[model samples]
Target chain A: MSLPTLLEVVNLKKTFVRRSGSFLKPKKTDVYAVNNVSFSIEKGEILGIIGESGCGKTTTVRMIMRLMNESNGKILFNGQNLCGLSDEKTTKVRKDMQMIFQDPYDTLNPGMRIVDILMEPLHAHKPNMTKEEKYQKVKETTEAIELIPAEDFLNRFPHQLSGGQRQRIAIARAVILEPSFIAADEPTSMLDVSVRAGILNLLLDLREKMGLTMLFITHDLSTASYMCDRIAVMYQGSIVEIGETQKIIDFPTHPYTKALVSVVKDLNSFIENRETMILDGEVDSTKKTLGCAFVSRCPHQEAVCHNVVPSLEQIDKVQSVACHCFGSSKMGISERSGALV
Target chain B: MGKTVLSVENLSTFYKTDKGISRAVENVSFTVEEGEILGLIGESGCGKSTVAQSILRLIEYPGKVVKGKVFLHEKELISASEADLYDIRWSEISVIPQSAMNALNPVHRIGEQIMEAILIHEHVSKKEALDRTKVLLELVGIDRERWKSYPHEFSGGMKQRVAIAMALACYPKMIISDESTTGLDVLTQSQVIALLKDLQRKMNLSIILISHDLPMVTSISDKIAIMYAGKLVEWASTDDILHDARHPYSRALLDATPDLINRDKKIVSIPGTVPNLVNIKSCCRFHTRCPFAFERCKVEEPELKEVKPGHFAACFLEEENHELTYTS
Candidate 1:
């Protein structure tokens, strides 16, 4: 039996109209920053959205957080449509959803003390709570995030603490309210490798303790595989592949996912006959395409991929891939299915 | 390995601060041979970049290379005159900085910037420099005609490639790429590393790739040097470092790093932060975070010694016959 769904994003789309050229002749082109992104987070599950820059992973999260209004589609949180909600209702819903930004240096205010930083969310959300209660909650959250001897850190400023501590403070702030869903966007990428593992483990610990559902966003496949139960590979504003972490890494169906999985350098990869696919050209998000988004850099691009956009299709019990070749015999889908069996 | 291209001996750089002197790079010794790629792996503030800057003699006031010698092709660089250093700067050794966006001038054309390096170092005509710039651009997988475009016209990966082109403009014998592929995406980073590897093979150039990325470094570098708290903890061939890392810090780093292939393996982060370098004691720098630290590690500093053939590790545990096993 499966856990209850906490957050479900359905066919969400976000487009930014770019205005270029002279004042007299402005070229207004529709740049689809995010197109038809759909995913859900089960209760107490962590789903990672993995992609490179300009791949719409951030925009998708921003849209889900209601930071940016979506151009189309529905976001059903707890069976309630978040779109077209009033400001007050949206603010109420935001208490259950909290986001952890990418950069810890810019996220936390420099002048604020650790106590003030952690208490800001409570002040905003729980206005009726007593000042003593707020301070007690701050100490408790600080201790929960493993900032031991909480008194030593609560009085200090963000600058006095290290990069890893500042990040822990940031996490304390995010989870201070004990939200059900947390969106962490590359939370550990800014940290060093040694400190990064600590942060990842802390997030896992928080999820276990609070039973919090999480949307983990990162570009590194290794990190995503480690932290996430399910992985979604995004390319130019679309989820090309989404599946269980092991299945996605072991038998990646999409060409982009295959390329992404191939490029990841690990210790064991040195001894293996690694067939690395060095894809040319970067993601061009400005251009609107009727065909597949990854066709420009994909290795297995067929003639039909240029004109027909392939929808996400269920390839197995837990794997879903958006590729035209998956259904047809052009790219050995049967061979992949045979291996899967 | 071919002939020695660059050799750094007992190099120590310290930053003068209000508290005390911060030893950034301490008694570091390494040699880069011709056509060999050396991977310098370390955490932030661990003196990886300090070593690169000290080799180039770019350390300014307040931060000085107080001791040790840097030699390029048997010519001393630490004691070289300003004019001699200026002549050898890009012509003999060049640098691809971490941030390619800021390394390049926004107003100038990419081709003009690359040609500037060539024209300043070599007695070449403007037309010859332009031709050479075009060739360099094409060599790094950028279109020759795009040289006329400004920096903003290119993407992040293209800008990094342009930086690589500028580094190769003078035909320098050695290039120091200090986290050049940091901000780029995975595929783009792989492409950039592949380009550098290809250029190294074709031109017989030596490269010192300084990054915290262990896997990427191990995949490309002939030798790997692991640094911890301004000290060279371990230095060995890529295979040896991968299979037989002796230093506790190196083993901890490899364990800390998440791997895609080994999904079942648990990533254990080293507890505690890196020690402050200011007025540091003569002890193992990684003792605070080392899992196997003992009384000997807290008092005595372990020197980098050859534990095996072509493998060097700085740790007292190697002498104690502590059988270390790394399960990848």
Candidate 2:
């Protein structure tokens, strides 16, 4: 429906070699950060990936960017398999796809001034461009991120800037290449709460102004709901739910989604009266799964849920949920436990 | 509520700088009922930590609680001696700092460190302390065997749970978790919040949760208070504060937050940063940043007055009109 589906990821997988706690040395057991994950983004659409930490969200983005090789799968960017591309081709492809990391403190170079740091990406991508051209591009990008007056901040190092200003430099760097797609990984998590909204608004404004298709990664559902058009809720390495923002927020079908929605303390009196569904324990990233990854914490989880991994099925016009009991009302409100609803 | 466990009245703390003294807290008052969780929501440098540190007299030199009172039950803490404060710091009121890993001693075994606190406060034998420590570890969902492990052996979430367990060891009536789960991942934060709620119910304890995270705090706390530049701008029940916040600062803060459940029509950030708190004048702390700042705000600091049944707001608009016009 949109601009010929610019990027498509078909069944991507990645594994990290983690060391187990023993004298046997670091064994090669896969972390399974991403497994058989498939999704596509239109030319100028912002596709959001929502997940807890260790949920393959980062790995998936890294794989698409070709920062790390996918264990197996096809990533077609502009009808070219990113996995099949030669080192030279990949380098060229990397020019158009860039990532903005979560920690601006760690991402931005402490030694370099703001101008030089933003200029790094341009120097690398467009080596043919003159120094003046690159410097002008850096100025424009800085101005776009509202690091204006960019002239005043051009010579300041990362340490000299505030948390919000440092992040703006990082964003400027990522966008200086004028990448078609961006993977911003929790960009505002490290910034102060007062300054976080400024960065987010910048991203949204830049998306329209610069024609960017961003895959925003964050754990805060509030931010995701506000920023994203279509939300993909990922648990462990799988997309458990995918739908339009309003439907998923108002009438979530998956138990995990419901639990997450229930706990989203509302600013309305109605939320005060609504019961909360408190999920116990942590999201188990270490579990080897043949069935549902959310079964451990899902209150409505049945024997069948433990036996098979449910696929995403259309619940309505705009929402699709991956859960064994999504079709029924049995798992709605009756299955919750002790709470001040 | 079982009983009133912690009562703070007109607590004023000032940070003395080379320039001059900046009043960080002014006549802030709040009470935490037993088995209650009072969430203090604010941006950074809002003087929330100062309030927490003042309760334990943890505020160091150059920073002092100039006036006002703090009471743990009936014990007056404003003028308490250093030795008395030390005795009550952990035994009566303990704090879980922002960084769980940094709060703990890195060199010692975690179990041994916790046992030290138990031994110091309870006057128990080493063996009894060890046993009590194990019980506490199990209570916090950590295996008792983890007692032998070092701090580095555990993950960030595990370290947080251990820190919480150590705080529970002395049976403190009030626990102040200063951004306790801020550094952790969202999943870990939720689990920790659930565990905190469980422990509060079981122990019938009072908690003062200080965090920059507004939405998360609203879900967990019994009531909410918004602080700005060392002043309590608003304080109300979690329901009323979130639903009908009267203070302009509170409204802007709520607008600033990215709603997890429902996104706002437009992303509206609170314009500008908090004023630098050094040699400040008699004007309202939020006047520099407030969208509705008028002549009255710049000249006179608005007093926090009762707006609704339990809602308290500090703004000249509310003071003059007796109601607030908050645009969603």
Candidate 3:
């Protein structure tokens, strides 16, 4: 039997209306930061949202975390719609949902001690606990994150710890409340190559130990492949493809996903002759296109791609792609429009 | 092999802080031949940037190049006069620093920034410099018409290309790119690296590419230098370092990086953090993290020596020649 869905995002969208021109005649244009994004995470499974900067991967998660209000859609957490929830009810729900930011240096409070920093979450969520009980929980959580000799670390500040250690403390604080769901946003990108593996491993171990569901967001495809069981490829605020990690890496159906996978620099690929699909232009999120978002940079673009947006269609049992080349009657449309371009 | 354009010998740079001296770079040495790209790689705070700044004599107060000699075309740079160094800086050696894309002045046009470098070093008319700036922009694959655009008008990758164009404005023989592509996305980074390689081939220019990214450095560089805690642990050809690395730290670093082609490979992170460098003990700085470290590593410092011809490694395990077991 399949695991029950823990967090589901349906028809989520975020649009930012920009104002320009003179004070007398201000021009307004809508920028679709996130356009009709939908995905669901299975219990105890890790889902990764992979995309470059300004692709709305972070924005989607931010809206889920209630850090930013979504323009439209439904966020169902444990079968409850989070969008219509009261502020007090949302606070209670936030106890089960935690976020780990990218930069450990800035996320942590430099002025506070490690004990106080970790205790902040407990204080908010469990206000009735005694000081001794809170202190004991803090020590246990500190040691749980592998910061051994908890006494030594509990008294220190964030600045005293290394980048890896600081990140561990951040993780400890997030998991202290026993959050069933966590969203890690490029957690290891700011770290060194050697330390990155440790954090990734720790997260993996934590997921197994606590039965936690994770939303791993990253710009690096390799990291996504390593940490995630299922991957979602985002382009211009939309998931162009979603599939199993190995399937996405080996057989990417969408052109944007293919381009992303081709550019990953690996050790073996360095010496071998590999075919690289180099896209022409950067991601233009400002331009509101009526057709497909990737039509401008895609090499296999046809006349149909410029007129109609392709909806996500299942190509295989485990994979789904949003591209005209992989839609219904895929070959027929491509063959007919092949002569025009 | 071409003529040696830059050589650094016994280079040691230190920062004098209130809590003793911090050995930022210790006895690091390497040579760059004409048109050759040497990849200097290490973790953050490992002194890769310090080595670059020392080579360029850009280290300021509190940080001093305590010992060493830097030779640019057989001319000693350590003791060179200020006037001579000024004339040699951009004209002979230029730098594309980390976050160079953001280094572009927001108010000025991209064309004016490229021409400013040329105008300062050489006595040329504004019109002539502008013409050369447009040509340089074209060389870096930017449209000549977009030269007049402000920094905000260009994308991140385009701004980096403009930075490269500015670095090439004076036709420097050697360039130092210190983590210049760190902030760019994977596709844009590959494109920038490809552009750098294309420019290196076309101009026959020597480059010192410094970054912590191993795969990217190995993909483009001819030689690789692996630094750890302000010390050069291994230095060899890209092939030798990739296939036959002797130092435990270098081998462990290779294993630590996540491999894209081989998804099944397990990433092995080193056990400990980089040791403190301030008034450090005379021993292997990587001993805390190196799995093969023995008693000798704690008591005595290993000098970077030639284990094989043209390959240098600072590990005692090279002498023992143990059977190879760890494989990625």
Best by lDDT: 1
Q: What lDDT would candidate 2 get against the real structure?
A: 0.81
List the candidates ranked by lDDT, beginning with the highest: 1, 3, 2
Writing each residue's lDDT as its tens digit, candidate 2 over A237-312 gives 8889988877667766676666666566443322333233434455556667778888777666678888898887
Worst 10 residues of 1 chain B by lDDT: B319-328
What is the Å distance of residue B179 in model 1 from its true position?
Answer: 0.6
Taking the tens digit of each residue's C-alpha lDDT, what string does model 3 give over A85-188? 78999999999999999999999999999999999999999999999999999999989888899999999999999999999999998999999999999999
Could you give the DockQ of candidate 1?
0.56
Name the candidate, 2 or 3, with the larger DockQ value. 3
Q: Is candidate 1 or 3 superior in TM-score?
A: 1
Misplaced by over 4 Å in model 1 are: A127-129, A265-279, A334-341, B320-328
Model 3 chain A is weakest, by summed lDDT over 10 consecutive residues, at A267-276
Q: Residue B278 deviation, candidate 2, in Å?
A: 3.3
- The residue-by-residue lDDT of candidate 1 on A66-123, one tens digit each, is 9989999999999999999998999999999999999999999999999999999999
Top candidate on DockQ is 1
Q: Compose the digit string of candidate 1's lDDT tens values, residues B152-266.
A: 9988999999999999999999999999999888878877887898899899999999999988898889999999999999999999989888898888899898988888778
- Output the better candidate (2/3) by lDDT: 3
- Go through the candidates in order and give each one's DockQ: 0.56, 0.44, 0.55
Provide the overall lDDT of each model, using Cα atoms, as 2-decimal numbers. 0.89, 0.81, 0.88
Task: Choose the strongest candidate by TM-score.
Answer: 1
